[model samples]
Target: MLTSVYRLVRPRQFELVFNDITLDKSHVIVHPVRLSICNADQRYYQGLRAENILRKKLPMALIHEAVGRVAFDPTGQFEEGTLVVMIPNTPTEKDDIIAENYLRSSQFRASGFDGFMQEYVSMEPDRLVALPEDVNLSVAAFTEIVSVSYHTIQRFLRFSHSRRDVIGVWGDGNLGYITSLLLKAILPETKVCVFGVNEYKLHDFSFADDVYLISDIPEDFHMDHAFECVGGAASSKAINQIIDYINPEGTISIMGVSEDFAPINTRMILEKGLRLFGSSRSGREDFLGLIKLYNQNPDLINQLEKIVGAEIHVRSIQDITRAFEIDIHKIMGKTIMIWEN
Candidate 1:
């Protein structure tokens, strides 16, 4: 048995639990796993599904996106030492629950299965991807978050008519910056504009060419595509702002998770012929593409340094809950976690 760490959540509380992982005697033993905590949180903690599988009246570990290294794997595909990232999404292993369709039934590692906050973790060899030497552990920690942008952008491009479309991303948070970068990376000719609350965050990334602080938005700007990464009432207002600027027949991809309802202009949505949708954890292919980008561009670590606001080691599980309660802006570009064994 190996000792590991896991985060847990309830309707209104957060906790951490130490876990024991054991391999069946028949399974081969693999060694030395590298693990790190993540900065992102789960969408919801209470639901019917949460009660069934985890058997937890409360939820388990909130963070879903992170990067780690595989110390060992029996298959030899992942050897003793490999810098890798885990794609949290996993297909349902349950045979009894037939998903109406594969898309409807897919599961995720941190969501419904085991997650990565631990002293050691044993993962499937095929699930791991070795990182490039240039990728630092801290910046690489955001590989999953970065992929969220990549996946969202690809979805828009795949469904849109033009590759050179103009895109306006709402919010200048880390996700917003990465979304712009991913679009620029894939569609270099695409015009990228950003809506952010803080002018500083907007300037942090070179790719957000046209940035605005809601108060000074350009009314005439037209968008073929837009992304919603703001997660509060403020963000909802930003979404409304996006609606004002989008062109007729435009598409808005919402990837941010919010706790409040921001009214949408239903009439204008119809009048503008808008197609708005949301995205959560990404697909396997998107994660793979993120890895490829991390490998190809050595400077991502440096560029990403601005987004990882701070780092906090886990002294106790209680700290995890407190971590989230603190102002997120104070910790912008920072990562908080309990690091002790």
Candidate 2:
């Protein structure tokens, strides 16, 4: 069957390309119903990536965060019309020591292959996770990123010291809000504080134990651990600032994406005996665990509802372009496209 794929032929340009998708019993067909715009997708749409990288990766469908209905399930595991979230990381091999997301052989959607910006996505049943039928569609669209926070926090739990009294999340963006919210649900007894430069954005973290502007933090304030959600050129400053305020031996989980190398203070890291690690795309298990968490805590999804920003109905390339433009101009929050193709 021929499938309609929207590809970015160049910056600020999208072309409708058709590709043949073999109708096989091994693959399940998903009709993407709701797609979320990501910063990575924005980078490609705006030509923010390196020229070489863009030259190689452009003319490819973008968007990894999406939810859809099972249009066809030959395996009989999921029924037709069932709601599901697609996992982007496709692993070629399994390893006991390294998770699938961490494996070098994994092919991530949008990054390594055609993403969900198509009429239909063909993926193995194992790459899809069922979601509650009544779940919020706009909130569900960005499950991929939420699962990243879930995956990172799970690792932080295993790697960090037992001092779970206070945890700091730097950045008041959607990620920081989600990370701090997840930390509260996962570690209710622990305090989660968010730090950011924007007071307006920081106010959105109403659930946080406390929100402080980075420059206004108390002199004696400290946290047992920190998660850096501030990426881009500010990556170095966020990491180094965390180092100064975090307690000795605390684990710093890096979830930010930076194009240029951001030099951090390694001297203080060594002196403080800090442990730093980076987390990116998540695996199937992370999505499963996160959905379970959402089910257990209904209020969690309610909180997620607050971050659902502009929801545009996209039925054509022009609509998709308008959606991306809206996403770029928004101060914060997720921009979702109700995929009508």
Candidate 3:
């Protein structure tokens, strides 16, 4: 069968390319139901990435955060019309010592390979996780992002000290909000404090124990653990502040993406005996874990509802462009695309 794929031929340009899809017993074909725009997607769409990187990565389809329905599954693992969340990180090879997401051979959608921006995606049975029938499809669209937070916090729990009293999350963006919410759900006893510059954006973090502007934080305040969700040029400052305010031997999880190298205060890190680690894309296990969390805590989905800023219906290539255009300017929440095409 021939499939229509929307590719980013260049910055601010999209071309619908046709390709033949071979249905095998091992593969499942999924039709995208809803899609969510990501900051990384925006960078590529706006040509904000480095010139060298763009030259190599352009003409690739964008969007990794999405939910789809099984149009055809020859393996019979998932029935046709089953709602599912698509896991974008496809691991070509696995290692015992390293996780699938960390493997160098993993092909992540919207990065080096084509993403879910096609009419139908032909993937392995393992690449899709079934979504609950009652689960909201719009919220499920961004399950990849929620899974990332779930994955990061899961790692943080294993690496951090047992003291679950106070945790600080820096950045008031959607990432910070989702991470804070997950921390609350995972560790209800722990106090999650969010720090950011935008008061307007920070106001949405009502689920957090406390929200404060980075400039207004009390000097005496400190946390046993910290998560730096602030990426980009400002990440350096966020990490520095985390180092200064985090208690000794604290574990810091960095989830931000920055094009240029962001400097950290290694001297302070050493003195404080801080353990810093980075988390990027997630894998199948993370998605399953997130689904379990959703099943356990029905309220979690209600909290996630606050992050839906704009919902754009995408039926044509022009609608996709308009969604990205609107997404670039939104300061808060996630811009979701209801895949009508």
Candidate 4:
């Protein structure tokens, strides 16, 4: 079957391309219903990445976060019309010791191969996870990113010292909000404190135990561990600040993406015996685990709805472009394109 694919030919330019999709017994056809804009997607759409990187990756369909309804299922694993969230991380081989997301051979969607910005996407059964039937889908569209936070927190449970009485999350963005909220729910005993520059954004973290402007954190305040969700130029600042306030033997999970390398205080890291690890994209297990977590706590979904931003219905390339433009100017929250393609 030939289906319409919207690919970014250049910066701020999208063109429709048609490609053949094999309808095989191993694949399930999915109709994308909603897509959430991510910072990584924005980096590509705005041409913020290096020219060489863009040249090698462009003329590519761009979106890794999307929810869809099953149009057809040959193997009967999923019934027709089942709502699901598509997992972007595609692992060619699995390892017992290494998780699928960390494997070097994994091929992620939108980054290189065609993503879900198509009229119909042919997905393997294992690549899709069913969503809650009555849940808010606009919030569900960004499940990929939320699972990322879950993945890191799960790792923290294994890696960090068990004295997680207080945890500090630096970054007032969506990732920080989700990470902190999950911590509050998953580790009910832990006090999740969020630190950020924007007062307005900090106010939105009502679920957090404490929200403080980075500069105003009381001198006596300290946390057992910290997470740096602030990516880009400020990542170093956030990481270093966490190190300064975090107790010894604490873990620092870094989830931010940066084009250029950010310097870290290696001396302080060694001095404090801190464990700093970087977390990138999530895998199938992470998505499955997160959905299970959501099922147990439906209220989490209700809280997630607060972060849903503009929902623009997109049918034409122009509407998609307008959505991206609107996403660029969004002060906070996730921008979703109600896919009508």
lDDT of 3 at 67: 91
Model 1 C-alpha lDDT per residue in residues 1-341, reported as the tens digit of each score: 75645556554355556667776422223222223333334333333233444454334555555555555465656555566676666654544543211355775655555566555655555455667655666666667778777777777776655635688888777677778777777776878888887887788768656788878876677877788888755767877888888888888888876656778888999998888877776666777787777667656556777676556655555655455444243625555343454
222, model 2: CA deviation in Å? 1.1
Instruction: Show model 4 residue runs off by greater than 4 Å.
Output: none
- Every candidate's lDDT: 0.63, 0.94, 0.93, 0.93
Q: For candidate 3, what is the total of clashing residue pairs?
A: 0
Candidate 3 residues 1-341, lDDT tens each?
99889999889999999989998889999999899999999999999998999999988999999999999998999989999999999999978888899999899999999998999999999999998788888899999999999999988888888987999999999999999999999999999999999999898888899999999999899899999999999999999999999999999999999988888899988998999999988889999999999989999999999989899988888999999999988988899999887
Best by lDDT: 2
What is model 4's C-alpha RMSD? 0.8
Q: Which of the two candidates, 2 or 4, achieves a greater lDDT against the reference? A: 2
Error of 1 at 184 (Å): 1.8
Worst 10 residues of 3 by lDDT: 129-138
lDDT of 1: 0.63
Worst 10 residues of 2 by lDDT: 17-26
With candidate 2 superimposed using the best TM-score fit, by how many Å does residue 178's alpha carbon deviate from the native?
Answer: 0.6
Count of steric clashes across candidates, in order: 17, 0, 0, 0
* 2 versus 3: better lDDT goes to: 2
